[model samples]
Target: MSATIKYDDVETGQQIPAADYPVRRVNLVMYAGASGDFNPIHWNERFAKTVGLPDVIAHGMYTMAQGGRFVTDWAGDPGAVVDYSVRFSSMVVVPDDDEGATITVSGVIDQKLEDKRVLVMLTARSGDSRVLSRARAVVQLA
Candidate 1:
């Protein structure tokens, strides 16, 4: 087990450093194929435009999963997340390029909870938009 992060050591207003998450076209396709979410809006730019979206959009769940990965990496275990939620604030446009779209995720410890838990207010931004709003997670420190 990794060293436990003590809840008492964290400050309420401390901002967690932003972490970059790379989402390539292939990654989106794989996520679609794996998750069986073959929404045309996710892969077909023409369809996305027809629906009034700026460009091909990524799956909301895909973005959420990426955020989950970020939190898990910090906690050193996926199971360490006690709760997590987010509101879709904006769509993540995925262009067909090598750099892909990078989602920058950051968080702040909003409050300390009993029993080594803390409420973390999260932010997920891509390009100039806030993709995940009202985002928060309850993480259990080991």
Candidate 2:
């Protein structure tokens, strides 16, 4: 594991470079198969509309994973993320087309704790809607 990020090198309110994660129908379908979440709303627009959604929506965990990537990428190691949480505030309505939706993830160092650990606050959005809320990750630094 590459835990090269030292606590002293980071500062509170330090902004991590934002990243965009594309989500096509095929991506969702693959995620469904991998996660055993074969919910029709994630793959079928008809079922999604029947449930009163704007269109077929991406999974909440899928959106959360994008935010998690923001933290893990900054930490340089997936295992460095000791804690993570988020609230599903909005839906990521993914359309069935070549150009699908994109989840934009951004993060900032919110706090520096003891033992070379820091709290990262994350924001993930799709289109005009904020899909994830109160997303935070505790990463163990070098």
Candidate 3:
């Protein structure tokens, strides 16, 4: 489906409100099972520590998906996003607790492109550490 947000309604440098996504150990475990990326670092705290990580971490792709979700949710259509990419800059450490950790994602309309498309730059952070770098999505707006 096409995006409900029109390209003319958006401007370069306009801010997209930040969204928080809570991640827990169970989420990582479910992700591992779904993705076939059964890496111990994603769910096993002890194994993660042995691998030099402070605690169990969320999968990089999972974190990236959160950023994509932010963009798609804003655009009002998942199919509106024609291109998306990100560089994994840091880990999202998930504690074994009720609150777990939170990944806060925000975006800016970086550029207005031809044919009703716009470049959206994304920022994803877990606590003070930026988890995704160079995150960008090109969306086809209505």
Output the number of the TM-score-best candidate: 3
lDDT of each: 0.86, 0.90, 0.94
Q: Which of candidates 2 and 3 reaches a greater TM-score?
A: 3
Q: How do the residues 1-142 of candidate 1 rate in per-residue lDDT, one tens digit apiece?
A: 3445667678789887789998888888899999999989898889989999988888999999878877777667768899999999998899888887989999898988888898889899999999999998999985
Q: What's the distance in Å from true for residue 142, model 3?
A: 0.8
Instruction: For candidate 3, list the clashing residue pairs, or say none.
Output: none
Off by over 4 Å in 3: 1-3
Off by over 4 Å in 1: 1-4
Question: Model 2: per-residue lDDT, tens digit, 26-126?
Answer: 98999999999999999999999999988999988988988888788778887899999999999999998888999999989999999999999998999
Error of 3 at 29 (Å): 0.9
How far residue 27's Cα lies from its native spot in candidate 2, in Å, is: 0.9
The most accurate candidate by lDDT is 3
Winner on lDDT (1 vs 3):
3
Pairs with backbone N, CA or C atoms under 3 Å apart (clashes), candidate 1: none
Clashes (N, CA, C under 3 Å) per candidate: 0, 0, 0
The count of residue-pair clashes in candidate 2 stands at 0
